[model samples]
Target: MVKVATFFAMSVGAFAFWQTMDKIHVWIALHQDEKQERMEKEAEIRRMRAELIRENKKRESLA
Candidate 1:
C-alpha cells in the first residue's frame, strides 16, 4: 500500500514538472520546418496536376 501511494505521488510530481517546461522554441522550430515542407508539397502537387492535365489531353486525342 505504501509503495503504491509513493508511486502515485512520484508520477504526479513528474507530470507537473513536465507540464511547465518551455516549449516555444521547439514549437517555432517545428513550425519553420513544417512551412518548408508545405511549400515543397505544394510544388509537388502542382507538378502532378500538370502531368495529369497532359495525360488527359493525350487521352482525348486518342479518342
Candidate 2:
C-alpha cells in the first residue's frame, strides 16, 4: 500500500514538472521570434537612413 501511494505521488509530480517545462519552452520560443523581428526592423531602418544621407549629399553637391 505504501509503495502504491508513493508511485502515485511521484507520477503526479513528474506530470506537473513536464507541464511547467512545456510552458517555459513556448515562452522562450515566442520571445526569440519577437527579438528576431525587432532586429530585422532595426536593420531596415538603418538602411533607409543611410540611403537618405547619401541622397542628401548628392543633392547638396549638385547645388
Candidate 3:
C-alpha cells in the first residue's frame, strides 16, 4: 500500500512539474518573438532616418 501511494505521489508531482515547464517554455518563446519584432521595428526606423538624412543632404548640395 505504501508503495502504491508513493507511485501515485510521484506521478502527480511529475505531471505538475512538466505542466509548469511547458508554460515556461511558451512564455520564453513569446518573449523571444516580441524581442525579434522590436528589433525589426528599430531597424526600419533607422533606415527611414538614414533615407531622410540623405534627401536633406542632396537638397542642401543642390541649393
Using TM-score, rank the candidates from best to worst.
Answer: 3, 2, 1
> lDDT tens string, model 2, 1-63?
999999999999999999999999999999999999999999999999999999999999999
- Residue 11 displacement (Å), model 2: 0.6
Give the per-residue lDDT digits (tens) of candidate 1, residues 1-63. 999999999999988777655476678889999999999999999999999999999999999
TM-score of 3: 0.97
Give the better candidate number (1 or 3) by lDDT.
Answer: 3
TM-score of each: 0.54, 0.95, 0.97
Structural RMSD, model 2: 0.6
Residue-by-residue lDDT tens digits, candidate 3, 10-46 = 9999999999999999999999999999999999999
After best superposition, candidate 1 residue 37: deviation in angstroms? 0.7
Tell how far residue 6 is off in model 1, in angstroms: 39
Q: Which residue pairs does candidate 1 place in steric collision?
A: none
**Model 1: how far residue 5 lies from native, Å:** 39
